[model samples]
Target chain A: MELFESGACDLAIKIKTGTISSEEVTKAVLQKIEQREYDINAYITTTPELALKRAKSIDIQRIQGKDIGLLGGIPMAIKDSIITAGIRTTAGSHILENFIPPYNAHVIDKLLDAGAVIVGKTNTDEFTMGSTCETSYFKPARNPHNTGRVTGGSSGGSAAALAAHECIAALGSDTGGSIRQPASFCGITGIKPTYGRVSRYGLIAYASSLDQIGPMTKSVKDSALVLSVIAGYDNRDSTCLNEPVPDYLTEIDSGISGIKIGLPKEYFEEGLDSEVCDITMKAVEIMKSEGAEFIDISLPHTEYAIPTYYLLATAEASANLERYDGVRYGYRAENPENLYDMYCKSRSEGFGIEVKRRIMLGTYCLSAGYYDAYYRKAQKVRRLIKEDFDKAFKTVDAILTPVSPTPAFPLGSKINDPLQMYLADIYTISLNLAGLPGISVPAGKTSDNLPVGVQFMGRVLDENLLFRLAYALERNVGTSLTYEGAVV
Target chain B: MSVTRKDVDNVAALARLSFTDKEKEELIGTLNNILGYFDKLSELNTENVEPLTHILPVQNVMRDDEIKPSLDQETALKNAPKHARGHFVIPKVIE
Candidate 1:
């Protein structure tokens, strides 16, 4: 009867066999949401009526001997940034508080086609900018593991929903560690596929070059199952690759034999927490024992990632968000004296402090006097960062490092200091800069009981290699801490 | 390395967000501290390095010149704050 704890594939089989009716499963998950929704603050909008309607349709199909889809009767959640037709899609900002999208994102369309029931829209940071979900107009999502700590942002709500058993799996966008970090914080698995691997037509853009839509689930196989359905080229997004999508679930149990993982010295440097470092090294040793070779690698530009990412992301954000002026759609001032007043009042009132800060920094970097000095120079550094990853990949199949320097901090810990919050994304940002694929798996737990995640970064379109290594580590780790009463 | 109030005002204007004088003063301090950390990048000699815009090797991905159906006017204008005659309406600019 507890459908939230089962894997998506298993749930589909149960539905097919009539072991559990789709209506019963939906009610169980809705009951779980009713119990824990306030504690985690995961869902911004819950759609029980729509979910029941969809479940009844699936039951009808089964009774008539029609073919049901792979994800038939499975309940799922989507990050608020992804548009859902006829649903209120607020990107955790006041700007579009009342805005209801008229169309679904490309991935949403795919999930519906697969017969997956979308239960709700999860919370996120405003425009997917902050590292902590605290920036949302809604209440900050709490870490289901530790109530006082944070669920990582801007996909924190999606991750928290999975961790708390509110949903089996969810969709999240990783612009710069949005999906991976939150998954790490909430003790779950998440993947950011290679750039152009998935369609981004319906995803709200934060940084066009860096944003990717991927899966956040309770296990590696579940993440891959969702990826198999969503990863493909679409004509709607010109940047989407026209290559063949891999059968990720087919290789979930593939052993990691003769696999080589790179351990970059730069990632284990001074700033990383001792507890995080110890757990990561243990994870590396576990992989080594599983017939995986360890090689010492150098990515000298690792330290430069923080600055390069902030500069480039903000610059793009300034340009992309320009479409939200008062004239067209989105929020507007109640009363405006003039044209300029309307523009200023609307933007100033709608955007949060962090969003405004990034926009200003972006505008400055792209200005007439500073463009060549700041923006252009940062772009050059971004090239060297990519080269570092390219050069390292030649010696190793994938690179392993801590997803974050530390476990999830307290809710309001880094909200005041923007730079400190940005620093939390140090390890995950460079992968975005290089457009590589990265996956985060449960590495180990800190001494104080917080979950630590180890990230595997792979070469372009080499997501299979990363998944193989992650599955090996997850099996070898040998400890599955239950969410109930695990927090100290 | 210290940012000035003038710098904050200029950046705000470029970003098209109006800030009160107190907010401007606060931002000046914050921006200066943040920009000060970026000085580390100047130490590295990146003269010959080319600026990398995208990670994947592919470039210039273009769609075919085929016309497609667009969103209807009603659906497009549904979220607009003010609209008239299938177009977004704004305050009059010219006298």
Candidate 2:
């Protein structure tokens, strides 16, 4: 395979062993980005000069007998939401279009410390409010498989970048299936670690409780390798778990023999496309052949997840986004009649339609008369959803479901209907609400040749199990995409 | 339970956001559509269920009182739209 076509794990080995120079790999990826990025629209920014400079330095360090960190010299794309010191982190919003973060997010520090070279920031839905990249203030990232379709968002750009071989691996933050859904669409492996598994210090907060940063990669093993580097506690984010970080690679190759997996009946009942259901069941058959048993389970409250998520997530978002007034950083209105006018005008003009709608919805939910009726009630139901997982995990090691109800729809299909778009997350949002870990591994493709990924959700902090199962599926099913170095 | 235009205006104001009349009218429909879906939550009995704000078990994540270096005035104010004398200049609050 070409340098840019290899997984991060393979690239890391080649760079470490001097079999291939980091400079060569970096050049190949930069060239790939130059060639295909226009078609995919995966990145909001591309830092070719900085990436090459970092790659050269890492090459020098390796020559000088210096330790090149875990991902040393590998080119990676970061979700624009994560703050990068001195880099324009727009979070795919007009409000922060020209904003440059003065400090690195916690994960950026870890990646830099590990010697990973950052290529650029990937596009996302404005403040990650929408599932499709169409909601982004920038051009939507079209699926690498089919340019006419979306690369399922709000981490759509990251997924597209990886799938298109524009970058070896990428960082994606998931709040209500941003990472996993795009990975499913782009035919890549994406993991949304348990809520507190990764630090949230630099991630532009959407819903503080639901937001998490994880890895999207070419293979399940690459996800494990990247997750190992990024998954650890930092004092900057209080919600980050102070638990011990496991070397996921150690237990990754462990076979999933006698592992009990659950199939939640609610996920299959309605709204699930027949092809997606068949693909999911086919993935189950492969796992079953590999000695993993499947059990019928009921997450009775699954139907309520969407409503619960919209209420709670939007409520938190309304409050978290309140900091973006014209005062500190980000866009400010050109001229204003008064302070209130400036605040109102800057925000209304800065934000897009979906973001404004969410803000409005959130404000209404948290308004004085509706607090108990909406936000509080959703919180209670959120507990019930988590309880469903907790109860099921007692009987099964993990649960299996389709990552998205259907594969990537056409770009403008559901953008006009907000409620219709919300239902797309019906299957994935429950895990986010429950603070559980979930991974999307490419299963197969639809008749239209679009990719489909099956989701494997595990108990909190049990990412190793998810990786093991994911690896088995990838190994046996052989659904790995052929990177022919061509952009459709 | 329907979100009227007046409610959208109130919420938009509460959010420190202003919408054009057309945007407000659009929001009235979108907000009501979303809020109407939220009515599904009321069907369940959450009478005594404890609300889960954060899923993590850790709370009151305290740190020591020791001082640590923070962003200098220049770096902190670097991105501010209006800054003077190392302070963010904003329209006068009490005028």
Candidate 3:
């Protein structure tokens, strides 16, 4: 395999053993980024000079026989939402187009401490409000598998970069399938750790309760390895669990024999593309033949997940986004008459159309006289969704479902209709609403040659179980996707 | 209830945002369409269920009132649109 095409784990070992210099690997990946970035639009900023400097430093450390942390010279991409000190981290939004964070997010610090070199900041949906990267102030990231289609977003850039071999692995934040759905679309392995699994201190807030930072990689083992580096407690984010991070890399190799996987009936019903369903079922058959048990289960409240998620996410988003007035940082409107006018005009001129729409909806939901009917009710339904998963986990070790109803769709297909775009997240939204961990691993492809992925949803903090199942499925039935732009 | 143009205007103001007439018209249609989806949640009886504010069982993290290192005034105001005398400059409110 080409140096840039090697999995993160493989590249890490080679770099650590002095078999390949970190500079060489970083150069090859940067070359791939230069070659593919024009067509893919996979990054908002490419820090080539900084990446090379970090790579050379790691190389020097290896020569000096010093401890080079776990990742040791791996060129990794970061989603633009995570704040990196001195790097322009635009959450694919115009308001913060020139914003450079003053400090690194907790995960960025962890990844850097682990010797991961920062390649650049990947693109995202503006404030992560949409399912596709089309909402970005910068144009959408084209799916690497087929350049005409979208890399399902709002982590589209990270997914595309990983699939196109522009980076060894990438970090993506998930709030209602931003990471997993895009991973599925781009034919990569992405895991959204359990709520509070990773710190949110430096993340650009988008639906704070649902947002999670996780890893998007080319291999299941890499996902486990990256998650291990990024996961654990941080004093900065109060919601972060103080539990001990487990050894996912060692646990991933364990077989899936006798592991019970549940097939939720609602996921298989109408709206799912036939080819996507068939591919997911084929994965189930492979696991079944390997002695894993599949049970037919019903998460009866599944139909309510979309509404519940939209209401709560937008409500929280409205409040979370209220800080972007023309006061401190970000875009400020000119010639405002007064304080109120300044706040209104700065936000109106700075935000994109979909962002404005979400802010309005969120505001209306939480407004006086309507709170009980919308925001409060959604929270109640969210509880029911959580209870449904809690009930299912009583009998099954994990729940298996398709990551999206269909594979990568052509760009501009669902961008106009907000409702239709929201529906695309139906299969993945339930997991986030329930605050659980899930992994999207490639299953196979559709007849059109588009990639498809199946999700393994686990109980809260049970990422180890999800990793084991995803690893087995990836080994048994994973598609080896190759794109035309994958030449290193 | 379905969102109307008036509601969009009011909500936009509450959100500290403004829109053109055409954008307002478009928002009225889109907001109502999305709000219509929320009606689906009404079908489920959540009468007895308590609202889940946070998923994890975490509570307020109290700590000693000790001084800690933080961003200095200059670094904190580095990205500010307008700053002078170690403070953010905003449109005059008292005046």
Candidate 4:
């Protein structure tokens, strides 16, 4: 098998058994990235030298008969928003185009300790703000399945890399379907662990309460492996939970005989594509045949989720992004005549159109005259939205829904309409709002052959249940990989 | 309440963004549309609903007040567009 096509666990075993050297595997992946990166736009930076050196060091440790950590020498790409010491981490924005971190994020530290080889950073929507990767200051990532379509954002590049076999597995951040939607679009598996299940210590902040770092991979088991290495408490992030990390890999393939899945009625309402709805329902039927029971669930505040998310996210973003003024850090205008001009010119040039739009909306909601009407009211509505999920989880092990209203839209299709763009996150945003764990597993393809993802949301820290269900669904869904210009 | 073009302009300025006249006109329409949709919230009886800051029941995860070393000023300023003597440089505020 091609090095990039090798699963994370398979690669680790091969390297340890002397069937393939770590250096050889790294070289193959680097070569594949060099050949295909331009078409997919998967990577923002390629660290071939560092990757090869790291691979060699791992090989040396293996020769010394030392037990390397889980995922030793596996090539992994990270979302650019993640901080990697000495590596340029842009978050797909011009504002921090040259920014290099002096410290690693907790995930990065864990991945390195596990002996995972870091290939490069992948692209994202600038500051992880868009559903489609189109808003990136860097080029929008193309869906490896079809070049005409987008790989979903803000972790579009990470998913795209995984789909195109540019990397074995990649890291992605999901604020509102950033990871899952893109994973769905790219026909890969992605997981968004419950908020605080994974530490956010070195992730560049978007909306602090909603942003979560998660895993994107070619298979469900690979995601479980990656999550095991990264999910843990950290002293740096106060929000990170202090609970013991569960043995996720061991829990896979646990029988789904008694698992009860809930399908929310509102998720299949009118705006859902007929094809996506059909595929999702068929997935439910398959689960039922596999001895899973289904129940109809209602999350009545679904209508308010998009609005509530926007208000709260933007309100928080307005405060979180306040540090980016020309005074503190990031890009500043050249030769400004005054401080006000410096701030205006620098931000105007630094942020892309989408980032600017969110910042404006955020500032407006939090502005003095509008705080009560917008920000405060939205917080109250946010409670109702969370209550909707809390009420649903009482009766079900997990709630199932479509990842996006439709499969990946064509690039530039909804870019001009901000509201239309925001609505794309409808099914996924409420999970973030409720701070629950969710995963997007490829259910099947539409009749037209575009991949559709079925999302399973679990209660807080119930990622183990989510993964077991995803693994079962993944086995039933079978492989649906599609490449542009290739026969499905 | 109806949002006006002046509201858009003021918010844009406060956010430190510059927009073209055409972009401004377009955004005025979009923002108004979004705000119109949000008007639905006013009809709901949320008088007794408590505001939700976080969904998880986590709170007050405070850390000790002990001083820990911070990133060096040079490293912090490394990404600044302009810097001088380990500090980010900006244009003069008042002259």
Candidate 5:
């Protein structure tokens, strides 16, 4: 495979063995970014100088015979939503357009410690409120395969980075299919670890309860490699689970024989694009051939995931976002009559359309008159959504579903129709609501050659199962996805 | 379940945001459409279920009371849009 097509693991090995200098790899990736960035719009910011400096240091360390961590000298990109010290971390919003974080997020610390050189921060939906990169103030990230189509988001830029070969791998946050949907659209491997499995310290919160940091890579093994580095407990985040991190690199290729996978009837039913459904069905057949058993199952509350996710996520987001007052961090209004006016004007000027819509929905729901009817009721329904997974797990070890309802869609096709845009994530939202680990593995493609992905969801903290399954599914079907960026 | 223009203004005020008349009109339509989805949640009977605030079973994640170093005033004010004397500056609250 070409250097751009090589997986992060292979690149790291080559770097470690002195076969190829990390500087060489970083330079090649940077050149690719320069070549294709105008068409793809994947990165919100590029750090070519810093990446080369770090890569050169790693090369020196190797020459000195010093130990380098597993991701030694690998070039990676992070979602702009994750904070990095001294880097302008805009969560694809104008509000913090000039905000350079003073502290690195926990994941940034981990990625750096693992010897991964961050190339840049990638685009996201403003405050991660939308499913496509269209909401970004930096502009929408286009799917590399087709310039007219969107890379699924709010992790669109991370997926785009991998698809366009702008970087070897990337990190993204998934709250309601932010990571997986874009991975599906871009035909890359992405996983949303079980909620709290990875620390959220320094990760800009959209909805604290549902967000997770995971890897977006060109191959499944690299996802495992990256996950192994970033997962584990940290006292900085209370919600981070206190558990021993598993060695995913060693566990990824576990055989699939006798593994019972659930094919949720709700997922396969009407509303799924026929091409996506066919691809997912083929994925199940591949698993069956590998001796995995498929059990027909029903997650009765599947249809309610969208409503529950939006309500709970927005409610939390409304509260979480209140910290962006004009008095403190981020953009401030030019003039204010008083403190209250300052707050109003700053927020009004800062947020984008989708963000404002979500905040309004959240405020309306949490209002005294409507709290129970909207926010609290959604919480209860959320419990039932989790309960659906609890019941399904009794019959099956993991669940298989389409990562997205369709492949990448033309940009602006559903931007005006918020409801239509929301429905696009129907297949992937339920996993977040249930707080389960789900990995998107590329499968077949549409007639027009748009890539589709299949999602394998496992019980909370059962990310091991997800990695193993995704690895096998990827081996069976992940080949032939060599399309690069389109020239605009 | 339906959102009106009056509802939009009330929610926007609570959210500490404002909108132009055109934006407000658009918001009213968008709010009603999204709420129509939330209305579906009311169809299910959740009368006796416990509200799940957080997914994991964690509470009161406390640590030792030993005093620890913290972000200095300078770092705290690093991203402040308006700051003076090592503190964030805001519009006057008094008349």
Candidate 6:
């Protein structure tokens, strides 16, 4: 039986029932990575030996009548940012090209505990910066649907792997729509969990306040499974919520009957690709017929989201990225004239163009005299944006919006224009700014077959509700592209 | 909003990064263009709005002031580009 078309849940049952072996599933996924990664560039590192080892152990445990956990024998890919001990983890930067971590990230530990085998590390925008996954130091990760187009990034590789069926599922981090945007472009489902919902101890920080690690998968139910395993408190991350983790699988099927969904007029306004807009409106109608109510609401501060996000995210990124100073690890400049010379050369040489641009921008924003006008003002507007969502949530249960303005665009289109690239994140950045839970599910495809994702954002700590709504939408539109498009 | 070559050079210095004359010219243009977009925020008035440093309500995370085992020097220095005698090697300081 070809296990590549199935999801983690289905594969778990197959492994538990003796219908298939864990080694077999791992082999299939590994083969897929080997075959498709050349064209897709989805993986930065593929752990064939380790994956086989984990799989062989799970198979042995099953033969001995031992109970494996929920993710037992499921093959998965991890974004490069997550630390995996003894595995070469590069957060898609040349500086960390050969640096291997001495410890596993909290999520990696959790996934291993749940019997998930990580097959590879996916590519990402360098330092999780860029909207298109083009900034990766390794190579550009192309969209699986159309080779000429790009996978929306910083979590582009993970989303691409999921789209190409190279891995059963993968983990992605969203600072300002990294996960959701790529998931949208690749035609998969991804959840940017509430801030602090997942531990960030191992995630390479871009914007500490807004960065979150979440799951990208072929289906909403699979995302729920991956989330259940990874989401929770870890003392290592101060921001990790101490609240109890809910069994998302239990209530996901509860359906969004009588759920008052908000259609933010601002999201449907100008610049949204008409086809993308139509697909989301059609999704609303599909749910409206299924007992979901759509309400016209406004996030008045929507227009300010781009400027505000750019300022604040870059500010945080500048500070957070200061750690890469050519000191204890990573890349270093050779034969520096002085300590100062070493710091400048190592960073200037190690970082890519976009990373350098952001660091410079951030440094400029936080510099004296200009700080209050830019950084402080952006933070103030950020509050207004969050308040806007808060007020709208009072009247509606959840908000639905288009994931991106357009479908997968050609790779080079926005690369040269910084502002144009930043605008691609318009719909998704505010959720991060406000620290809310947002999920992007494949709603429909354009006439040209490019995928369009519909976003559903829930109030803080309302991931369970978000999952339920995503499940509702998924059941109606059915864009689980892993099976439908996995003709290979 | 009128960022110039001098502004880019100053920011690059603060960021501890260096670039060539050509790159600096490009940087000045890009920075100026981005600043033009950022200038849009000036249109909104935020007289009484509080700046949210963090989205989460939690502040000042506390942990017990206790000693625990830490990463050993050998493992910690494993990736150091230049190291000798359990210390990172850097260009001469305190000249």
lDDT of each: 0.86, 0.91, 0.91, 0.86, 0.89, 0.91
Measured against the true structure, the TM-scores of the candidates, in listed sequence, are 0.97, 0.98, 0.98, 0.96, 0.98, 0.98
Score candidate 6 by DockQ. 0.87
**Per-residue lDDT of candidate 2, residues A335-436 (tens digit):** 788899989999989999998888888889899999999999999999999999999999999999999989999989999999999999988899999999
Off by over 4 Å in 5: A479-488
Error at B11, model 1, angstroms: 2.0
How well is each residue in A1-488 modelled by candidate 6, as lDDT tens digits?
Answer: 36787888788899999999999999998988888988999999999999999999999999999888889999999999999999999999998998899888999999999999989999999999998989999999999889899998989999999888899988999999999999988889999999999999998889888899999998999999999999999999999998899999999998788999999999988898989988988989888977898889999999999999999889888998888988988999888999999999999999999999999999999998789999999999999999999899999999999999999999889999988999889999999999999999988888877787899999888999999988888888885654345334
lDDT of 6 at A461: 89
Q: In candidate 3, what are the lDDT values of residues A330-375, reduced to their tens digit?
A: 9999989999999999999889998988888889999988999999
Clashing pairs in 4: none
Query: Higher-lDDT candidate among 2 and 5?
Result: 2
Error of 3 at A4 (Å): 0.3
DockQ of 3: 0.87
Better of 1 and 4 by TM-score: 1
Question: Considering only the true interface residues, what is the Cα RMSD of candidate 5 after superposition?
Answer: 1.2
Per-residue lDDT of candidate 1, residues B1-81 (tens digit): 456888888778777799998889888877877888877788889999988776666678777799888888899999999
Candidate 4, A238-294: lDDT as tens digits: 889999998798988886888889999999998999999998998898888878899
Write one digit per residue (lDDT tens) for candidate 1, span A1-488: 24667767778889988888777777777888899988899988899999989988987888788766777788899999999999889899888788798888999999988878888999899999998899998789999888799999899999898888888779999998999999888888899999999999999999999999999988887788888889998988878888898888678678887888899999998889999999899998898888889999999998888888888899999999898787767899988887877888899999988889889989888888888778888999999999898899889999999999899999898999988888889899999999999999888787667888899999999888777888788787632234323321
> Of the true interface contacts, what fraction does each candidate have?
0.70, 0.88, 0.93, 0.72, 0.89, 0.88
lDDT of 1 at A205: 91
Q: How many backbone clashes does candidate 4 have?
A: 0
> Candidate 4 chain A, which ten residues in sequence have the lowest lDDT sum?
A479-488
